[model samples]
Target: MAEPLLDIHGLPGHLIRRLNQIAVAQFMEKMGEIAVDLTPVQYSALCAVKSHPGIDQASIAGLIAYDRATLGKVIDRLEAKGLVSRKVSPQDRRARVVKLTKSGQELLQQVHPVVRAAQGDILTGLDNVEQAQFIALMQKTIQIGNESSRAPQRELGETG
Candidate 1:
């Protein structure tokens, strides 16, 4: 007989919190093996810059669902570590565009496989079909969330 433990399956919020912690912890552990000290948030910021070259700071923060103040600290940390550069956008004087330096790109390439392996480990319990389904569900959730975030605000006088 299986030993009784916390009913994590019955608590979606608890499950999500635990899963996020576990995933992040495992990923960080793997990153340690590669001597990469950057946090997940930093890595995500770098990835945003990598995928969208010359993206503005505000846009990157929005894309990652990070608040401006927190994202600013992440950018500052990355800049201090020499992983990214922020330049005044040529098209928009008030905006600062971000990009990964050559060293940042190389570091990303080196650590990406380790990151993938860590993610794969998190999914090890799931079979191929389950893994695919899980990914599809996550994408769907993100799509719905994005749509909600982008929905226009209603005027004060407007009726539902």
Candidate 2:
């Protein structure tokens, strides 16, 4: 039988949706306070590049849970905006490494405090212990998801 639909008030999916809604709304508001024009996805891409210097475009896409095509467009937009640059990787001529430009670094500096403040606001309800626990649980959940995705496909003659 199919699983029952969850009610909006207390279900896991609903809670996650609500959390995202709140976080995004507050983040935008905080961004306006700091005069940053980038959207959440844009900031995320910028931060990813900043966090993982010398990372390849494909790796950035994987890290951010974005498809290659969509990440390509994002990189294009960032390049157009003078925020990021791509160069042929020294290790692999066929691969392109992505990095933030000076402008992008400056923008990140301007927005980083706002983002930190927003995160602080989000975690305000939780004590340090709870925050740590929450992060641990989230990591565990993601690890489980990764393991399931990497599990071997069943064969016709395979038995478990």
Candidate 3:
């Protein structure tokens, strides 16, 4: 093939962002084929709520690396869809605890295979070992991003 393209192919941030776009596209395509209509993020939040029943929004956001504001919206949508329910927390009345509804559980069961297939499609270019390695590398990169992002000025050798 000719190199008749932009220089982004060699840039990690550019490649990562492009890959995310592609992954979302693939997810949407697969979800459509299955007649499911959950955004990837919403599905993820549902899974988080299922796994951490009675969890608070802040805890779910932390688990998913999602900001509180965005996660709150996601939770709102889930509640609207009746896939999740939030109520005053017994442990902390000031906070709301979220849980999956029975309908949410059923939909999750139905959607699990489709989501798995979407993930498999995204990694079809790699063998099992390569897939595992790729995931490890991505996790490491995210971990570093999280750590450095917290103290960006420290990484830049800047003083407050």
Candidate No. with top TM-score: 3
Off by over 4 Å in 2: 1-6, 90-94, 147-160
C-alpha root-mean-square deviation, candidate 3: 5.6
Task: Give the per-residue lDDT of model 3 (tens digit) for 106-159.
Answer: 999998888886686787789989999999999888767774553221211123
Model 1: per-residue Cα lDDT at residue 136: 96
* Runs off by more than 4 Å, candidate 3: 1-3, 149-160
TM-score of 1: 0.82
TM-score of each candidate structure, all chains considered together: 0.82, 0.76, 0.86
Full-model lDDT for every candidate: 0.80, 0.78, 0.81
Q: How far out, in Å, is residue 51 in model 3?
A: 0.8
Model 2 C-alpha RMSD to native: 7.8
Better of 1 and 3 by TM-score: 3
Candidate number achieving the greatest lDDT relative to the actual structure: 3
Give the 10-residue window scoring lowest on summed lDDT in candidate 2. 151-160
List model 1 lDDT by residue over 85-121, tens digit each. 9999999899899999998999899888788767767
Between candidates 2 and 3, the lDDT winner: 3
Please identify which of the two predictions, 1 or 2, would achieve the higher lDDT against the true structure.
Answer: 1
lDDT by residue for model 2 (1-160), tens: 9887656667776877788888888888988887777777788789889988878877776666666677788888988999999999999998789889999999999998778767867756898899889879977876666535433222222322
